[model samples]
Structure formats: structure tokens, C-alpha cells
Target: MNTKIYCLEQCFLPKNWELLLSAVKNVAGFCKESGKYDIPTLPVKLGHSLSKCAKVLRTKAIMEDNEDVKKSVEGFLKLYEDEWNERISVKARQTLYDAKFN
Candidate 1:
């Protein structure tokens, strides 16, 4: 994710469409790696920050009139949605425990 975010930052340079595309690819790669880890929980703050980053990139792509960047942003958004859905909350854990115990 850090790598993805770094790539995203590089995408901000004016007329650097390649960098923007790379950033979007990196985000997808990071998401795939995260799934392999099967992380049970994610910090809410981190999630929010990532979400914000995606939103910013999306808007930037649109503003720049880059269709390829926009497509990449859509890919990143899909990855974000999948990753967030997999995240477990404390309440969810408690519910699982109760189900198992009862």
C-alpha cells in the first residue's frame, strides 16, 4: 500500500500520464499482496487515508482529461472496495465468538 501511495504521488506531475498509469497498476498489485496476507483487521484511520488517496487520484485523473488514468482509478476503486469489505471489526469478531460459544 505504501508503494501504491508513493506511485500515486508520482502521478501528480503535469503531463506524466505514464506515471499515473504505473501508480494505478501498483495499487492493484498492492491489493493483491494484501489479500495473500489475509489480514484480519485494518486500522480505521489507515482505511480512511487510503480511501481519501483514491478519491484524490480519481478526481485528478478526471480533471486532467485522461481516460486511461480514469480507468486505472476505477480499478483502484474496485480493489479498495474488496479490501475494505474483507476487513474485520471488533464487533464482528465478538459476534463470531458468540456464535461459536453458544
Candidate 2:
């Protein structure tokens, strides 16, 4: 079953957005060239991963069943709903800025 990882419509802050946009651009190119891989929606999966990355950052993770692991991730994602939108907004602005420049 596919799970909605996180809704990032109204979260995200004003900092670190540029990094997110940059990563999205880089990852888009990488994923396109790399064999089989998911084509992530900009500011969507990118935001989800950002939120999850923050929680898992510098933390040790244990292996688990694949399905169970995906569920566990969704549970973790729900907890981050609070911060996702803010992060997305900020990243979007950065994307805007980069567009203005380049």
C-alpha cells in the first residue's frame, strides 16, 4: 500500500530551502540517469525526505521487515506533519530565488 508520507503545503521555514531546491535539481538528474529509481515530485518527496532526514539525522537505525519498515516510516512521517509545510514553503521560495537568478 502506498502511504502519504507527509503533506508539505503549508510548512517549511525560510532557511535551508535553497539547499532543498539544489538537492532536488541534482537528484532529478541523478535519478534520470541512474537505472531504475522513483521519479520524485519536486518539493513533495523532497520535503518528505527532508523532514525524515532531520529526524533520522545522526541517529542509528535498525533494520526491519520491508513492509513493516515502510509503515514505521509513515508513522514517523505523520509526526512531522507539523513541520513539513513550513519547510516546503521556505524551499519553494528558495526555488523561486534561484529561478530569478538563473
Candidate 3:
């Protein structure tokens, strides 16, 4: 999925940086959620995908010499890291456990 989108963005959407950036940002946001029915690993899976997508987009941004898009991709990459790297609060951990097991 990341490779396909990257190819299309690179070959077809070269002048449409906003759309390309938006796609990554949308996925990045979605991957941050831990909704009622979401499994504990949901965010991790989506975050991994987001990381892959963002890395490719970052490379494309660099190739295009577009600092704004590059910066945005970097931000998304940071978000991807935070999705899994942040330590869970005790309260939040309880909530997640209940959601999955109860």
C-alpha cells in the first residue's frame, strides 16, 4: 500500500503535494485512536503503516525540495513514534484491558 501510493504520488501527483500530505496525515491521526472496540494492537499496526507511508512521502518531499511537506511528514513520523513509544498511564492501561477482556 505504501509503495503503491508513493509511486502514484511521485508519478501522477507531483504537483499536488497537499493531497499526498493529507493522505499520510489522515492515516497518522486514525492510528492514534484506541476506541472502545479497538484492539490494543490496532494502533500499533496502523502506526507501522503510517510510518512506512510517511517515510516514502518524506523522501518525495525532499526530492521535490518542498520544505513544508517535508516538515509535515516529519511531524507525522514523530506522531507515529509517539503512538507506540509513549508510556501508557495506569488509568489508560486499565481502560484498554477492560475493553479487550471484559
Candidate 4:
């Protein structure tokens, strides 16, 4: 079995199972290498820059035939961005105290 496939299956929370899959569908290439891209893994800071950087990195990784987990994070970021934009009717930064997760 593929390592990425296995990890994608084993990892993620039970409550977020569906959301995670939805996230993975949006981000096809996700692996540790792309996860190392200069962004903080912490939740807050990661959420802030994740959507943009993850999209670019994941797209590149897919082109290179490599999987990058950061891409998955990017998918989640986009979901939140879309939801927020829908609710507030504004494209703006909503979070504060930028930090991260590891």
C-alpha cells in the first residue's frame, strides 16, 4: 500500500473524518516534504498563510509527482476562507495572535 494513502487513512480525527477527506480531495498531492515549506506548523499562523502557500506548493508537488501534506492543510484553509467570505460577505483577515501547530 502507498505510504501517503496509508497515512491519509490512519491520520485525522474521527469527527473530522469527512472534512478531512473533503480537504484531501481538494489537495491531491500532500506529503512531508511540502509540509517543510518555511511555514510554521502551528495552527494560528499556519491558518493565516496556509491557504496561499499550500495551494502553490501542492500544485507544484502534483506536477513533480510528489505528495506534500502541507497541501492538505491548504485545502482546509480554503474551506475556512470560503465559509468566512460567505458569512461575512467580506474577504478579510479574521483571526488574530498568529501561531501554529506541529
| Each model's lDDT | 0.50, 0.45, 0.51, 0.39
Q: Write the per-residue lDDT of candidate 4 for residues 24-95, one digit (tens) a residue.
A: 333432234433222222333334444455466667667787645445545555565665333221211222
TM-score of each: 0.45, 0.27, 0.46, 0.27
lDDT tens per residue, model 1, 30-95: 334333222223233445565688678879879999877677667656655664445423333444
Error of 1 at 51 (Å): 1.0
Tens-place lDDT per residue, model 2, 1-102, is 222224442123223344444455565443334321233345566666666664452232233334444444444456446554554445455455655687
Ranking the candidates on TM-score from highest down gives 3, 1, 4, 2
Identify the leading candidate in terms of lDDT: 3
Weakest 10 consecutive residues of candidate 4 by summed lDDT = 88-97
Candidate 2 matches the true fold with a TM-score of 0.27
Candidate 4 segments whose C-alpha is farther than 4 A from its true place: 1-48, 67-74, 86-102
After superposition, the stretches of candidate 3 with alpha carbons farther than 4 Å from their true spots are: 1-37, 87-102
Model 1: CA > 4 A from native: 1-6, 9-42, 87-102
Pairs with steric clashes in candidate 3 = none
